[model samples]
Target: MTGISGGGVMTERKKKYGGLRSGQTIAICLAGLATLWISSGAVTQTPDKGAEESRAARGDQKILVRVRESVSQVRQSYVTVFGRTEAVKKVNIAAETEGQVIARNIMKGAWIKKGQAILQIAMNDRGAHLSDAEAKFEYQRLAYASATKLSKKQFQSRIRVAEVLSNFESAKSELAEIRLDIHRTTVRAPINGYIETFPVGVGDYLQTGEIVATVVNLNPIRVVAHVSEREVTKLRVGDKARILLAEGVKREGEIKYVARIGEQETRTFRVEVWFSNSKKVIPEGLTAELKLKTARKHAHKVSPAVLTLNDEGIIGVKAVNKDKSVIFYPVQIMEDTNEGVWLIGLPPRLTIITVGQEFVQVGQTVRTSRDEVELKGNSTDFNSVKSAS
Candidate 1:
């Protein structure tokens, strides 16, 4: 009876210990699930807060910048002006005597050589006057001959012979004057050039000193331009220049004259340049642009887009420092060309931002991306670039 009682107690204790062990296992599983849920919630909340802080920081940053450096080269600054071309020399053909135009050998627009006869004038009764003068001269010569022979032979008095000789000389003088008056009928050209116009045709009556035609010498052309007082000092006689026509043709020339006095109305000095027209393609009165090559110097050529104004409204360029901070540097513009502007400030070597230059401030620290910065150096040599920050 004592042994059976002891066995029953051991079985009861085993059952109680098993029930406590099962409860402990269930409690441990519930605690682990709660821990996992709390960790996941923290992971989601931390990222949202970090993203908000990053956006706020980006909004606070100010100013955008680009940098430019200087270079040495042949630079020129040209001013465009409207001008007209003219003939180097022009002449008007006029009638020298009053008469009817009998022959007009040269037509309008015809080219004539110097001293060429352009028209023939028929003088009314000129032929009759010339014949009468010739007859009287012959008569005078016969009378003078007879008187001289008789005086040598002592058949006439000395006084009578001298009086006849005087009469003969007077008749000859009158005849010569008549012949001269008849010869003033033909009109001539005074120069070698193309006839620009003709006011009278054949058979038309013309007066003395009447304009018959206009002639222009087209071998050498002249371009007339005006220069301001500021540019007058840069121009000198014999300076090389270029003449561009409206038709896209270009001709080379040299400055021939620079007026000493300024124009009364425009306040500009007149300048004349001469160019040879071998082909005669450039006509008179054509509009042209004159480009004068004045001087060349060392300068920095940069894109006009990179230029900016400072707080004081001074023209300058932005320069980047070693710390990626920007600073404004004032520059004197030497010239503005089709490619870029020639400037006179800054060092020869520099790193400038080409893209996104309008977004960053002067002193703000930016997380600069190496891909955004392009180093524009003046060199033709090849470079193997590595990533930069």
Candidate 2:
């Protein structure tokens, strides 16, 4: 038992000594690792690099970009609206006399001249009535003359002569009525136009005031359009406008009318533009686009690629200030054409950044590549860009 106890105590001392030695070796290995890291310059170099990068970010680096000097100019601009075309004069022909249609002079879609006969109705009994009335009128006229002559000679009473004169007047009125009926048998066009529709055909009997055909005068065509209340006030009679048809035809015209009152539902007023259609090639009810020159103003034309948005969600293009810092100016676009868009807000002379705008923010310093050629003219002339040194 004594030997066993002694062996157990020896085992405990051995374990304690072994633990101390392992701890000392671990401390020595850590010290070696620390010394190696310091000698390699990694510990000092890492923190220095982070500090250096932070300082450089604070206005230490410059972004490079391409820029141009854009200037605003006074130019003529127009307001374009899509609209529809209409005829200046449209009419419907109707039958004036009750008769059977014996002949139709022209078919629908035929051009007609003023006073040309369009249709002929049978004069049936009208001609015979006129002849009989004329004969009665002649007989009454002779009787009245004989009565007047006898009265003057004291051969007839005044009352009897007066009665004969009255009969003569009544017969004359009947004859005139019959003649008018015969004239109305032939329906004639009132104006020079084209027959749009013909409801009546040959041999068809028509009552008085029944529609016969529809005619449209196309010598002068009018384009009708609706303009909102905001733009209606700028339109006036005699203002020039350009009309473009959907079929790629273009016509120049002038404003013919503008409605004073606006439509209740849409709050838009009607406008009519008139132009000569001597050839009558343009048909009615065609869709058209109208462009009316509103007013002249100073504006800047810039490329669409240069446009950008600011932090506040405002749309504009960034420009380089004299100090090489970015300037964000809000822009109001006036017109957008194939060449470039015309904008209204910008300094008279501005250095606009084109490339690398997305990489920079407002008030950031930038290095710019300048273009040699610039806009030069009368209203708002462009000058050479300042030196980028």
Candidate 3:
């Protein structure tokens, strides 16, 4: 009985000890699982740490930017004005005498030279009358000479001498009238030009001062434009100009005239540019654009996007110093064009901020990158824009 009792107590102790060992093993497993879960979370956070390492620091983030270097260039400035082409001169050929046009050689739209005959008239009794007047005048002249000699010797009365003198003067006047009529029979061109209109034809009767033809001279064609009061002062006579016609014709010319007085209604002055049109290729009344050179300047060419206004509404651009610190400069526009703007009032050499300029203020140190020009476009990749190697 004692041996049985001892065995039973020993078995009970063994069972309790085994239960304790199992509980310890389970607790250890639970701890191991918790540790593994925590380790997995730490592994997931590694990417965030790496991202933080690559990112810019608090103050240092403000220091990097994209900038462009301003290069000085000699630029030509021009003032563009819209205008129209005009003929140098227009003329009207008129009849000098009354006559019937027997033969007509004029052709409208044909070239004509000075003294070129455009018509012919029938010669009637004028020529015969001219001869008859000359013969009578000669006879009267001889008679007058005889009468004057006789009077000098007191051979005849003074009345006869006076009558002969009157007859001679009458005859001379008659002859001159006939010659004038004969010369006026034929009409001629008075200038070198094109016959714009020829209303008279064969057998057409024309009176004195009647319109026969119209002509125009286009050589040295004129372009007429108007300049505003603000621009007229900068323009002068004989300044260089270029004319672009609507027909795709481009002609170089010089400013021939600038009106001193402004137009009352428009407040603009009339200006004229003369272009050589020896070929008569440019026609009158075509729309034209004239570019007149105003001045030449040493300036920097930049995109118009760089222009900005300060707090006081002063127009300027932002630039960077040698140390890559931001700076603000007031600039005057030397010229503004569709392609670009030429700016003045900056240092000879400048490092202007092209992108992120508005974000930074003056005196701030910023990182910079060069211009990465995309082909034929204005879009920029600022992040990828790094200074050229």
What candidate 1 gets wrong by more than 4 Å, as runs, is 1-51, 57-68, 74-80, 131-184, 308-316, 321-324, 329-339, 344-355, 360-389
lDDT of 1 by residue, 38-149 (tens): 8878435435877677556545543333343444665665545558999997998777678888898888888888878788888788788778778877887888889889
Query: How many clashes show up per model?
Result: 6, 0, 4
lDDT score of residue 145 within candidate 1? 88
Count of clashes in candidate 2:
0
> How would you encode candidate 2's per-residue C-alpha lDDT over 86-138 as one tens digit per residue?
98989888888899999999989999988999999998888789889999999
Minimum summed lDDT over a 10-residue window in model 1 is located at 380-389
Candidate 3, residues 166-277, lDDT tens digits: the string is 9988888888888888888888888889998888888788888999899899998899999889888889798889888875778899999999999999999999999899
Leading candidate by lDDT: 2
Best by TM-score: 2
Off by over 4 Å in 2: 1-59, 144-166, 310-314, 373-389
The true-versus-predicted C-alpha distance at residue 205 of model 1, in Å, is: 2.1
Error of 1 at 350 (Å): 6.7
Question: What would the TM-score be for candidate 2 when compared with the true structure?
Answer: 0.75
